[model samples]
Target: MTMPQTITVLALDVDGVLTDGKLYIADNGNVMKTFHAHDGLGISLWQKCGFHIVLISGRNENSVTVRANELGIEHVFQNSKNKIADLQSCIQAIGCTTEQVCFVGDDLGDLSIMNHVGYSIAVQNAATEVKTASDWVTSLPGGEGAVREAIEYLMKANGTWDSSVASMMQEHANQ
Candidate 1:
């Protein structure tokens, strides 16, 4: 099987990737999203592996900040109209090249930037054209561990999967 390019940084779009593309808006303006635990663990593993992770989204959701904070993701750009700009900014901030970046997204809004990234992945549930544009299409649907699957592929492709996961497991087991 062919391997994905080296992924030093991963940039993702939040809504469809992390939350099944559904918004839970309460009468009082509260937002709720169901995130898979495995996905969270995968992100933690990616961080442990020393890969930079960022959330670059077009829309702003209340729960995103909470979730990102929970995952210790420091590079988050919400309400970005031009994703490429945010992506460029993120690349600069992280001191990486476009070839070191992997972009995972699920909609039309993500097309331009995804096209430019080194590796572009689409969730199984993404729009047809978006899927067509991706270099890889994940087996998991949006919000159903797609991000984790991508992370695992990337981590393994970059040769950091095993040790990172072991370290994360050990750390958790110690608590």
Candidate 2:
């Protein structure tokens, strides 16, 4: 297996990646998405380590914006019909090349971006085609600690896992 390059920017899809691919519709006509708290904390940890995080989704959910804001993620593009274009724009805005970016996705919508990035990851519940295209596949299903798994895996590969963990632990201890 080929080893991954150092990744500086982490991009993600929302529905099927951060979610379980199940859209929860409430009786009151409101949409409720269940996000794993572990993933949220992982994103926070990633940011603390100075890696950029971007959320690209084919959805226009308010929850996506809310969640991103909560995580201090500034780059979120929802209702993105063309993920490749959006990803390119994000890369340019961040002044990073495709080789410095890692993308985590689940479905066909995520395929092109995954192919263009330096490292591609698929959640365990991702579609077969998506998984086949990924350089690495997480053991956890999407919206269920999958993002956390991806974060840990990438940090370890980048040789920052221990330091990041220590930083988080120190912060927790101080709290």
Candidate No. with top TM-score: 2
Please, what is the whole-model Cα lDDT of each candidate in the order they appear?
A: 0.86, 0.89
Error of 2 at 105 (Å): 0.9
**Candidate 1, overall lDDT?**
0.86
- Give the Å shift of residue 128 in candidate 2: 0.6
lDDT of 2 at 94: 87
Candidate 1 lDDT by residue in tens digits, 43-100: 8888876788989877787678888899999999999988888889888978998888
Write the residue-wise lDDT of candidate 2 on 1-81 in tens digits.
335548889999999889887888889877888889999999988898889999998878898888998899999999888
Off by over 4 Å in 2: 1-5
Clashes of each: 0, 0
